[model samples]
Target: MTDTTQPNTATDARPPAAPRRRRRGGAKTSPDARVAPPPQPGARPPRKPSPVLERLFALYPRLFGARFVPLKLGVYEDLLARHPEDFSPEELKLAMGQHARSTRYLESVAAGHPRHDLDGNAVAPVAPEHVHHAILELHRRRHPRTPADAQAGLNARLVARVARAIEASGLPHHDYAARVRSRDASANAVVDEALITLAAQAAKREALLRAFEASGRGEPEFAEMYGIPLDEVRRSLQQARAARTPAT
Candidate 1:
């Protein structure tokens, strides 16, 4: 203390901490600090549609046009398969458009109708008899020797007969312009024949129900196998029973 060494006081203080070490090379930069160019104003992104939506859109035009008849028929078949209830007038119109009336006629013929006679007794329409007879004749000519051939032939004949009768009665060509205009009367003839054939098939089912009842069998175990309703089957069965009973 007595030597008074002028103690390096003011200039030394650790050299200002070496200016924070200058970050080794320079101050660190963040990725966001870099500027990016902006996109052009008019550029648009491509539009895409789902595959299912695209398929439905593609089908719309055909589905709404006259060509939709086959589609409607397919839907009818599906409805008959899944649910045996008859389609309402509005539903038929929506599905068949111009052909609604014809479709309804066919359905009625296939299902048969009940009318009241003079004394207020119910009179049932005879199911497509002519058509059934014609089918039997055809099968007799074609498959004369098959096993259980008579019964099978009878059933086939009945189916065809019903289909033919309905076709003739309904006159489906009245609604189909192409059929009406075709030079081949044979086409219309064939269509009429077909209606009877279908009606006969329905009648054959009724006949089967009768066979079951005559044999003391319970209501047909598989009456609704074709997707027809159990109640409708029962109704047909009742009709068959009444027809067989002969009025007192």
Candidate 2:
């Protein structure tokens, strides 16, 4: 005898798995969780403007008048933000002076750039383009376009140094070295004139010293006679003697 038994289908059956939903905002998480990369170490932050820049902003009115400041200050600030960090305050001022002497600026002056309105203000704001041109020109000046430009600058510096050395030479001295070093006009004749002046000064100093010694170091009388400062008489005499002394 055989018995027919119906197996339970519910116990044998499994429901379909629900579809996997993606993450709302980010990538789906993988079975092996990913670790975020660490931030790079030792990254230098952007540099800020030097303190001299602040002073430059303060001096703008004196450097460039209201007429020149036509654009909103923010515009100039934006341009300055692009100003090279390597440029120093002195260099910036130098660039500005160079710009002022430019033929374009001079032509504008001839055309009355400094003209004023009835309200005691500039007729109009200075052309922003003009200012920008000056900025570019200044950068060019700093960079020096041609070989001659750099040489010219060096020559100017050498000439100035020569002039200073000649002026400071208190005794008869031949600065042939300076004449040779100066790339510009030789100041050799200047040395001759300076020597003459020094000789005269020496004569005067010697007379004053003789009078002082004769008067038993009387400061007031010697100073009155020479018409020199009484307070500086001792110092002047000492300096004069030192100048005449040859260096060992």
Candidate 3:
């Protein structure tokens, strides 16, 4: 006789399943459950490089073959924007051409390897800043600001420097008078000697201005190197301005 109440053998064969564990702090979550986090505000989407930039990159190596250096296209773009359309293209070409022909740039190209130009002549590469400066030179040349104008500006700076130096040097009249009295020299002799010393100092100051300008050093660097105070530099610049002013 068949037992009607007997459990199925297939159901009894499998072992009991383990209970799911919960997080120690947070609420329990299913393995399949997911929480999508909020998106970041003002997140920029990926940008495609501009066609002009891509073209420039493509032509760069060919233009300055064996000496191409990667640079930001935005810098040239800004320059191109500010420039007059009539000369912009020509200026860019000129700058790039100069870079290609520069011996310094060519040497850098072959820094560690045997790099040669199309005609098999070795060449150097330059930094983007060099090219940028070349572009600036073109603009400056076009503008033609006179050397005297430049000198005038620098001289104003020079006067400021001189004033600061004078302050640091103390009162020249008092100093000279004390020395003259100590030596029992005539007052007229002291005045003459002071005049000669003043003339020499003026020459030295001019020389210093030339040196600083030639070296391309700013005020801070010049002051630090020569032990002159910044205030003195400003004073010298002011004195130069006064000297240059028209007698009105």
Candidate 4:
């Protein structure tokens, strides 16, 4: 009865709270919201370790550990099915991509390691083309500082690399040529030169073998007559014999 005659001064002294203003679209703006500036053109994105990669390392230490191995083709499907609860398809795909492009993985491929599955079982051999490309990429990475004037030496190294890969493949000239054709004209030219060098080497070895067989002289005598090192003659003969032997 005492307050009914007059306004409650405590409530009247307090101002009402301000209403939140809405935008043109009726969406309320947040005071703490911020807009990030757009990324600069030609700027590289920052690199950081991915969370999925860490999880992969925890699960498959053998493949994703300090020592990496070449993974079998289509390993993405296996990973997706095996770890459905832990990872999404997109996350796993990106993680696998990062792993494959890593230097250690490329090294394994270049070294001609057999492709391995999740269980570390060798499923199939790495293709010759894959090995060739890996070697080329690794070479570029390792020789990033090579000067333009040293191009001849660089090309020689490239030819050597291609030749080594071709030899390791154990494929005939025509077969390797057919399998390794690509849009890279310079690489193709290098491969052509490497093949020619290999053919020349084979011809020389065959001639040496024929000469040794015709001379009927022992290893030392034949080497002395041809002015070649006995070890070299022996190696050449051994290689020729292996080449002639039909694969069983």
* Best candidate, TM-score: 4
Higher-TM-score candidate of 1 and 2: 2
lDDT of each: 0.45, 0.49, 0.48, 0.86
lDDT of 3 by residue, 33-55 (tens): 86765668997765664444344
Candidate 2: stretches off by over 4 Å: 1-186, 225-227
Output the lDDT of residue 2, model 4.
Answer: 75
Which ten-residue region of model 3 has the weakest summed lDDT? Answer: 153-162
User: Candidate 4 residues 21-94, lDDT tens each?
Assistant: 76787666577765676779998777888999999999999989998888999899998888889999888888
Considering summed lDDT, which 10 consecutive residues are worst modelled in model 1? 64-73
What lDDT tens digits, residue by residue, belong to model 2 across residues 1-248? 44436544676356768998988988877778877656579866655644554444455543344334232323333434555574454655655455456544444443324333222355554333333233333444545546665444333333333334333433224543333323222233333444555567667777666667777747777788778888789876775677668777
Question: Which lDDT tens digits does candidate 1 get at residues 87-177?
Answer: 4435543544433233332333334433322222444543343223333334445545545543333344444444444455443423422
Structural similarity to truth (TM-score) of each candidate: 0.23, 0.30, 0.23, 0.72
TM-score of 1: 0.23
How many clashing residue pairs, candidate 2? 0
